[model samples]
Target: MSLAPRAVLVHRRTEYEELIAHHGTPGQAAFFLASRGRSVAEVEQRHRRQAEALARAAAAVPLDWRRTRVERADLPRFLFEPEDVVVVVGQDGLVANVAKYLDGQPVVGVDADPGRNPGVLVRHRADALAALLPAAARSGARHLEERTMVEAVADDTQRLLALNEVYVGQPGHQTARYRLAVDGEPAEPQASSGVLVGTGTGATGWCRSAWLERGGPLALPGAAAPALAWFVREAWPSPATGTAQVHGLLDAGRQLVLTVESDRLVAFGDGIEADALELTWGQTIRLGVAPTRLRLLG
Candidate 1:
């Protein structure tokens, strides 16, 4: 007999939970929020709604199939099987957070609060999972929309993937110093805020902001394009550093290389700062299009 497909639901911690975690008690959390002119009742309501949506999604799972629930913070430690259908329930960012860990598994992005949240990535309604789950298990390829991803390889050892963008900078967004090279070109030393490399899926985010502020000829890539865009933020000209090669495209056969000249630098993807790679001086990191793509289901 064949094994039934598994549905893995991915979610994040609620604001109320976070507050309580930090403050150690609901009363303390409420007091802290009240001091900031916020109401604990609002947090309670949001948490209640999220719990209801999660329950509904879980209830929709077919009895024949196995089911699992995971938190966003636990994704790095979670092992995903090939036959598992990944369902992310939260804001658009949650989908991005989960995409990097998946191989080619079909992802259903469920908008937990559709009325209040602008869900560009999480587009499906919570109630639609009942129908969507079976269809996805049966014909995932037909409904799949592939999105390009960015990969960073450090010293030919550690590798990190991103659904949206990779941030290479200091711990606190401080000005960083590094030597950059693109497509086998001469490396140029630079002093700036940091470097941001993103795929077409991330064009509407941080990459878009950088593109608007600094004029670049190359537009962001589309979802299915096998290309990436890179921007050097606030490249300050100094006697030791140059700002000439700051923005460009990273298509196939091309790669962006950064050598950390600072005492320490951190590289993270999909806005997960907790799980980041630490780079020291003289460490080289390469950024390019990853071989794997995110198969997002509509």
Candidate 2:
């Protein structure tokens, strides 16, 4: 007999939880927030709402099905199964945070607070999970929207994935030194803050800001476009490093290559610098469209 499908509820610690963790008690957290002209009641209210949403989500799970809960911090260490239905409850970024760790699993993005987040990835409220979860378990019962994702693979075979964008640069905010080569272009030595490779899903965020700041040279891709947009952040025009190759579009199957000349560079996705690929001098990392797409449920 086939095993029953599992429902994995993913969430991050709330501000209230973090505050209490740091301050040791509610009273202490309240005092700390009061000093900053903030209200602890607001934090407590948000915490209560989050707890209620989680409770509703938990109650929606089918009685016969197995249920698991995971926090955002533990996603890197969490093991996901193909048959598991992934439910992300929190902000839209939480969906991005978990997308890298999943392998074609159907994901349900749940917004704990409706108006708190920009309903990009997390489109549904907690009450919808009661109906969505069972349908998701039934093979091909619901529409699954596939969102494009970017991948960075190092020479050492370390690969990183991002739903929004991947940043390749120094750990600190220093200028990065590298030789950049894109498809149909000659390799050029360039000094810049870093390189950003992003998917259509991420075009509205960092990628859009970078593009607009540079006179909007390239058209940003849509959320489901099977393409990627890249930019060179603040490229320095020096005799040794040229700024000719600053930005471009990467269609499917195309790649942008960067050969590090700096002592060390790190490749991280979705702004999670804590987890990244460390690149050394002479190391080459390839950035391109990932083979895997995020199967987001609508």
Candidate 3:
């Protein structure tokens, strides 16, 4: 196995306890070590208390602790072979500090406040964990092939961590124009400061705000799942000024495009850009979704 149950790849999160309280392997299971000691002495003390409590749970799970592993979590000294990991989480995001050698495990969050509503907690936790766990052991950092897209110009499949949408809003900027084309199909582009093309998975973030302001169609806001709850938060103006005539269906890979622009513009993602590729107002970018997305542990 890549990681022993209580061995390495441990990330300490705030509610790691509350989260573990719910999804933790119930039966007598050993914890490789104790408190990772990041926050303070008091915090370390809490790990001992929590470990003891976990030891006494009705499930009677084994909470055996080895020596205090100190600051790092790693593969057991004897288990040199690598195994994919199951990230242990708690109520306070990811228990980033306590768990052992979480070097390359598929980390998952348990829940922040399972007490508030146990069912809800598991629903979210499971949703996140299901996809994350497997990725840890099997993923290779490379774009195998593009199997996704949101617009016809590129792929926007449900990538784990998406680069995000583009928004050009400053109140005073005039909307840009471009002729839309899917593989060179002429679909005239409308005028807008900038058009936002987000991964279907990223429909809710700030891009949606732009959607609302632009009077775009009211899409149902769901959990970004295939059939999750979707409510029409906001949309663009009448006639869909910057609508995707053939926003090709993105699957789960990379995308590429070639655009011929006739204007000057710069776009933003999440708000800032580390790099920019100029599109002469109408040049198409072969934007493809990446295969790997990092899981932000608690």
Candidate 4:
């Protein structure tokens, strides 16, 4: 009977101490871990080890292997629905995606601080479903870890969280230099070639790499936090193509524009490139930060 009712376990193994420490009761919390991606032999080995570890921590904790509990469940339709806390051991992207299933429940990342009783949480850097959890603007959002769904149901403030980064890259030449306007001011790339805006969260992903490779400065636009806009470096090898098949845009601020100048380019959502657009210039495309964030339990 944790103060938070029930918690959903996200990691594969270990970190059970945190769940036990935070739990008001032993059997109140439910756990789930991903064992699908691995081979049958690997999964079995990992599963046995993790189950033993968890069982030792809290004999009451129920380990469910039904629904995948991911951006999309990978395997095993998780029998577990939603829980109070979600402990994430992987990166922000995975955490953020997992956050979606919990309906914005308190997800903590395992960046546990010194002597924090495993009660530490890493805020997500990317992932829309995660960022929409809650905001500092809302009173309830402040006291996160202790929140229960019943107490914080009406939450609607937008918090932008990106694990990787929100980028607008290019495709023409091996490198592309474009003019960036912060609030409509000229901020061009000097040496490395493109410009990107990043939040502290985004700083962890692409923007951070850009910084390492001389991209540009990372800025947080709070007044318009709900929007995750990217000016784009214009990746069209050819030009703009107006087919939805050519999904990318050139965000110009005025009208959301899209065109096909035989734009030979590719756009990637999360470097996965599984979802990209063939983009061009002059067409104003819109890209804003996601309102939700990825939450994790450390």
Candidate 5:
């Protein structure tokens, strides 16, 4: 017999929860916030909204279906089944956080506090899950979408995926040294802060900021486009290094290859620097669009 479908609810700890965890009690959390000239009431209100949203999402799951909850921090250790229906009940970043670890399970982005968040990824209200979940659980559902993701694969076979952009550089603020070769072009020695390669899903945030700073002519791809854009941050041209190839686009099959020349470099995605891949000298990493897309519910 086929296995029953499962609903995996994903969320992150709210600010109030974090404060309480750190302060040990509500009174202490309030006092800590008051000392910093911040009001704990706002945090509490947000916490309530998050709880209400999560409850609504939970109540909407089909009674016969299996259900489970996974916090953002625990996603790295969580095992997702093929038939799981992911419901992220938090800010848009939480959806991005879960996207990297998923294979092709459809994700339902639930906006806990709608007006407060941009609602780019988490576009659905919690209450909407009542109807959405039923349709999502059905086989051959057409209410799903595929969002492109970027992947970074090191020469050692260490690979990292991101829903947004990937950063390649030193873990610290120090300059990074690498030889960059785009597509089949000749490699150019570069000394800069780092390199950023991102998908269209990430174009509006960090990728846009870098593109605006340099005002590059290349247009960023759309959310579902099979393409990626890359930018070299603070490329300092030296007598030994060049900056001729600063920013460009990577089509479906194209890749941006980087051979590390620094003592050590890190490749991280979607701002999760803590779980990044470490690259030593002479190591090479390739950045390209991943074959697996984020199966998001529309």
Candidate 6:
């Protein structure tokens, strides 16, 4: 006899709480905001709303399942079991943050303040979770949408997955130099800001901006497509490096390989800068469709 699957509620600290944490007191935080002409009362109200939303989401979890709450900053160290169901209560970025830590778990994104910050990924309100949870747990439920994910593997060891995209660049937003190759084509040296490898879920984000700039005809992949898009940012045409292979699609059975030419390059997923992989000169990183996909509860 197995136990009921655990329900993990993921959340992040509010702006008011962060301010108080940094200033060590509410008065100091208020003063800091007042000095900058920001409204401390508004911050307090937003925090109150977030607290209420969290309470509602937690109470809505099915009584048969074990429940746990985790903060966003602590996601990397949190241990997730195979049978766990992840529920993120925040904006769309929170969903992306939790996605990297999960391995095929069903994720439900609960929008805390739908009126103020509408999100594409967070399609459900806190009040809807009562009915959403049970349906999500049932087998053969059509409420789940499988979102494509991208992966960055360094030398067959360090691997990082992203629901949105992976950024391989130099620290401090400086120029990055690397050798790029698509599929098994000959690698070419590239000098630019960095490279962005994105999935269908990320097409509307940074990838969309790049695509719009290039004015390419091909559309980005959809949610269920098993493909990836690559764009080299500001690829410089130097005497040594060429811009011919700046952007392309990585279809199935194909890969985009990048060899580090800079002294040090960092790879991070989903805009979480703190958690990253360091690649030194002569090291290679392969980017492509991840083997695992995110099962988003719609």
- Summarize candidate 6's per-residue lDDT along 166-265 as a digit string, tens digits: 9999977798999999866999999999999999889989998999999964679887799998899999998999999988888767889999999999
Task: Give the per-residue lDDT of model 3 (tens digit) for 1-298.
Answer: 2333332222233334443555464221123122333333343445654443222221221133111222122322324223434333333212322212233333433442345434211223433443443343346623111111122222222111222444332223555554443334555444544445554434555556655654664453332322111111122344644444423333334332324344654434433333233345434544434333323333
RMSD of 3: 13.2
Report the alpha-carbon TM-score of model 3 versus the true structure: 0.37
What is the Cα-based lDDT of residue 8 in candidate 5?
Answer: 99
Best by lDDT: 5
Q: lDDT scores for all predictions? A: 0.90, 0.93, 0.35, 0.34, 0.94, 0.90
Q: What is the lDDT of residue 111 in candidate 2?
A: 88
Would you list the clashing residue pairs of candidate 6? none
lDDT of 2 by residue, 2-22 (tens): 888999999999999999999
Per-residue error (Å), model 6, residue 296:
0.5
After superposition on all CA atoms, how large is the RMSD of candidate 5? 0.8
Q: Residues 1-298, candidate 4: write the lDDT tens digits.
A: 5232243445443344344446543343233222324233433444455454333323222343121222123412444334344544333454533443345555545321213222223443223223322331133455454211000000122122233443334543344433233333333222122334343444445545545443443343322133232333333333321111111122223222222222332333334343334455433333333344443321
Task: Report the lDDT of model 1 for residue 198.
Answer: 96
Evaluate model 5: give its lDDT.
0.94
Candidate 5 residue lDDT tens string, 1-298:
9888899999999999999999999999999989989889999999999999999999999898999999999988999999899999999999899999999988999999989999999999988898998787777679788999999999999999999999999999589999999878999999999999999999999999999998766899999999999999999999989999999999999999999999999999999999999999999999999998998888
Off by over 4 Å in 3: 1-163, 167-175, 211-264, 278-283, 288-290, 293-298
Give the residue spans of candidate 2 off by over 4 A. none
Candidate 4: C-alpha lDDT: 0.34
Please give the distance, in angstroms, between residue 117's alpha carbon in candidate 5 and its true position after superposition: 0.4
